[model samples]
Target: MTQAATSDTNVLDLSTCDSEPIRTPGSIQPHGFALSLAEDLTVLQASENLAQHIGSAAAGAVGLPLARVIGDTAAALVVTELAATRVLERPLYLGTVCISETCYFDVLAHRYDGVLMLEFESVERRASADFRNLYPLVGEFLLKLNNTVSTDAMSALAADEIRAVTGYGRVMVYHFDHDGHGHVIAESLADGYHSYLGQRFPASDIPRQARELYTLNRIRLIHDANYTPARLVPAINPVTGAPNDLSFAALRSVSPIHLQYMRNMKTLASMSVSLIVKGKLWGLISCHNETPSPVAFERRTACEQLGQILALSIESREDASELQFRLDLRRIMVSMLGGLTQGADFIDNMTSVFPALLTFARASGVAIVVDDRLLTYGDTPSDEQIRELVGWLSIRAHGDVFHTDQLAAGYPGGADITRNASGILALPISRIHKHYLIWFRPEVIHTIDWAGNPHAKEGAGPLDQLTPRTSFSSWRETITGTSIPWHKGELELALEFRTALLGIALERAEQMAELAEELGRANKELEAFSYSVSHDLRAPLRHIVGFSDLLLESASNEDLEKRHRFLKNIKESARLAGKLVDDLLSFSQMGRAALRPSTISMNDLVHGCIEKLAGDTHGRDLRWEVEDLPEVRADASFIQLAVYNLLSNAVKFTSQKESAIIRIRAERHPHENVFHIEDNGAGFNMDYVHKLFGVFQRLHRMEDFQGTGIGLANVRRIVERHGGKAWASSVAGQGATFSFSIPKELPV
Candidate 1:
């Protein structure tokens, strides 16, 4: 009674072909269907069929009664089996099950009246004598090794081991997409073949039918395209009892174009070891044979065993990817933190520190939240634009990189911004961190040429573009990897990163508020300090001057010589201290003073300086040649101070000369016309010249030059405040020249 029974398909019947059509405890048969039974063989003689196939004598125990033969508990399962073959007239799939006490074959049953015949199919008992049969050992090795190091290098290392273990023409680690578009990403080919390193293919060639079955089933073996099918009873689906074998190669009537394509790709027999990540398909480890060849039973078994571990290894790689992303993030944040302290540009600093970030994030351009007028370098956004975008980002509360799609969701009101842009990444810049590192990625548009007419070839094995995707359509969906929804865990992890960033933004806001408060307090303290110093020092200055006069007038004649000398020294010291305090007060006041611009004649100013000096001290022989001078807009008092300081310095330093030769001239450089007070003086080291204009930075000793060092500093302060710079050029024991410029007003 071993017959392929196809009585009525396309019709579902709940009516029992056997007794009662009993439900299998948890099963509801309304959704369940029945199968027709195999007929015309002696019920007992059928015992040989089960015995010869299952290698168990108890299979012969048929027709002894349903309970004695298979037991009543298995009744519904057997009913499922009968419905399968009877309705479909082809093979069926049954869940894992047991038959006689000693033997098991996943049972697929069909019955007629009191008569019942059941078929058992092997789940996977293709074990062979080889090292690969011990999967447990390899699994442990992979698990232990994964913790200490990366598997990519280890996988390459395993090439020799894998080749020695499984003899195939070429063993490649083929990566696959969620849609089953696969490519041979890594391979160990013998030689003499085109490399498939960066090649891609269509998912439809594998077909939805094939990809779905790959996870539920593993260890596919095609001895040859021409290999004859082994004789066996067929089965139907357990749920629907439809023709069951869903294997890709099992399509006996598959297109001839597909067969040729497999051959064209130089595959005689192939065994693909699947690398599944999560429940979604990730990639594969496919082994190919160029010639018509068969994988030995052991090698096939080993490949399958190897696949199980590789699948799990691929799954755990998610955590590895996350960890690396975090490490890179930490490194970037640390670099940004360092820039804040060192006064470096945040974006540029991060670029040098995280060089691979561009490639990792697929960024075409990176920008920071910056003001163009304030930041003179890099592709800084204009102040007007920056202020607007910053306000928008703050209002919308942007935190992470967003695909163009995300803007529609993040800011529904920001639809116009989204339309103008392809993608935007918003990184926060906090006032507490002055470097304010924020990263922006502008979408780089790629003008991809569609295979314009995709599917120029069909009937190609695993090479046809099937399903909704076509070469003619835009491939934006595939590039994003966003078409298939993210797993719950992965989406949650992405959300966690956003949560961390939100925390940072809130902390930044608080820091900014605190900074504002601190700035106000500092201003008050500075005003109080300035006022106290001014008031407290003036009384002592007046008393010192008054006492010095009294001492000079009242000293006794006998002690007049010594008393006069001491009194003179005290008077000089007191006057100098008083002058020092006045200079300090002036420096403080200059910080808050507004500019008073005037058209000052440079020649008039130099002449005025010479006349003042001439009146102050008896004339020394000097060569004072004033060149034609340009009228410059400047503060009149500050310009006088500049000329006075320069004249005073030249006069004092050149005092030692029997005939001092001082030259006053003006010359032009890139931006401004500089006037100089040049003199052959006792100059200092050229290297320390930069420190010359700073307060208390006089080159001459106090006894050598009877003047305070504040004069040159005051000159520099005034020059800078006039929107120009003051500098001196000199060599030790040689002459010196003091030059200053008043910058021209710039256009707004």
Candidate 2:
């Protein structure tokens, strides 16, 4: 009953076996018969051996109504049972029905793609396990399953339980790794059975299409691998106009290549129940037998249920394990960060916390890059190699965290460091500072025992070129240059640590920036102080020397009036020099003095400043305008000096005016209070405003304005020390206004 060779497979290459259409094989196992029917119960196609199961009357069943082939009673029962089952793709069992006087078959029906598929299995083939036997087996398995502690324990329990129920020679719980290769994790074998408990299988062993089919059809069985496959009567269904999609069919004939695979393993019958966890095919509960063994549908159903429970147990345990790992990482991070905060040097802090840092992500070695310096712990690459790897990572990275199990594959420069750093997990703490935290894992060399040499193949045939490997002996392979992969919890915890470390790095960077700015300002102030000392202080001293010399010469000539005038001139020059020194001392003290803020009336402060400068305005006809000023909290003495400087400048500059007009006012704001003093004076050009507040900076000539240029600079320093600023605006020769602001809530 084998399918005749077709032109489609004439050039089939052994390499392209994965593309073989296994689901549309247009055949069924000899143990059962299948029917493809239309919506109206018309038989579109039937198995060629239908007569063996039913009678000669139903042999040519194609193009006939289901009632004409299997009789009205059986067809009516199928329609009635299917009517009660609302879902599609899952077959519903319709209790055993007698087709002939001695022929009793268990019927199953399901619908897919507008076609209803009916399958019949003869009850005489296998003695059906009654509920009395099925219940105790399932209940015991569930009870023990709940008691199992780990995935391996659960898998072992499942293999034993499934073998107990199905009477298979051996059962193995196969588990797939992240790379798709499978290995047996647990096994239950009968006496004298050869074990494959530790053997691995390549991903190609079960081709991609076959794995996809396993997901859709959770349970599949080959009653007898050596039995002939019963081809469909018409080969193609009239409704689909092609081979029927038997993905969800119970008795669908599998690929010939797979049948050959089973024979190579010396297994005449096999069954597989997919372990579908979280909607993905995680693994399989594979069973094999040396002799022909057909499992009843009821026993197969129990195995499927057992597989589901096993998948759930594995998922739950994996979740619990991940949670525990994350909690452990968190504990390690807390201790490590605590150590970090104890030291100011980043490298020193990391060095002290190195042990917990390694334990944080289960890394074998660690590298901390700070301020362009590389520090290593335990097994790691050389400093030069690490720097090169970091450089490459900086260019290839798309995010703050990057990880790979095969660093040599990911980074070309890492090839030389495979023994020490085959894998790396890099987290950039601060890209601006070139700060990075990298963890390394050394190469893990191990040998793998594959079920067979996956590379070996037999010579190709013309029609069916693909051949399953004949040998099932153990084939050893040595793996190198790769480390155990980083788990999801490990990567996730690394990201969390990166976020926290970035915060600390950014804060440190900001503090450094502020320190640099302060240093620059201090340097500028030192330069200005030097200039004032060399020029401003020297001028007054020279004047006193010249005046004293003149007085001494006039005394010898008996010119008492000239001598007295010279003495007065020398005395005045000395007083001016002393005043300049006093101003400089006050300016210097402003920065060192701590703020002593108290509530004060701005009105009284302004009036006091005006009164102090009354000496300069005594001879002039002056007019004053005062406004009600807001109250502020500030250092009273400093505010007074600042006000006095502004008022004195306003009066001295307006000395030539016939009527000097001065105005004082204050502006209130939510955050601070601003005050202004306006005067009709000989105002300087606006272009030179930037020099108004600088030490020894002046706009007018020395003879025209009789004072040192330290007055405005002192004003700026005093106000600034009180968390305020002083500035002025003026139009040339028209008037000038000086303003300062004091924050209501001054900085401590």
Best by TM-score: 2
* Model 2 misplaced regions, further than 4 Å: 1-15, 56-59, 90-98, 101-109, 121-149, 164-167, 190-192, 277-279, 294-302, 323-376, 380-440, 452-466, 473-481, 486-520, 544-684, 699-748
lDDT of 1: 0.52
Candidate 1 displacement at residue 283 in angstroms: 1.3
Which digits, one per residue and each the tens of the lDDT, describe model 1 over residues 91-189? 234444454444444443433222233444433432213443456657664765566355454444344345555676676666665445665455666
Error of 2 at 395 (Å): 10
- lDDT values, one for every candidate: 0.52, 0.83
**What does candidate 2's lDDT look like per residue over 1-748, in tens digits?**
1334555653224565777788888788988788888888888888988877776433478878988888787788778877777747887677566676677678878888568889988777333235466667767888998898888899999999999989999999998888788999999999978898989888888988889999999999999989888888887667667878888888988877787789878999999999988888899999999999988788888898889889988888888888898888888887777787776666687899888877886778999887667889988888988888878877887687888888888788877999979888989876665668999998999999988876775555543335567777889999899988998888887888787776766666787888888678667666776776787777778889998888777767887888888888888889988988898788788888887889999889888878877887887899889999999898899888888888888888889899999999989899988999999999989899998898778899888988778789888888887788888999999989999998988886
Model 2: ten consecutive residues of lowest lDDT: 1-10
lDDT of 2 at 554: 74
Error of 1 at 282 (Å): 2.8
Q: Candidate 1: how many backbone clashes?
A: 17
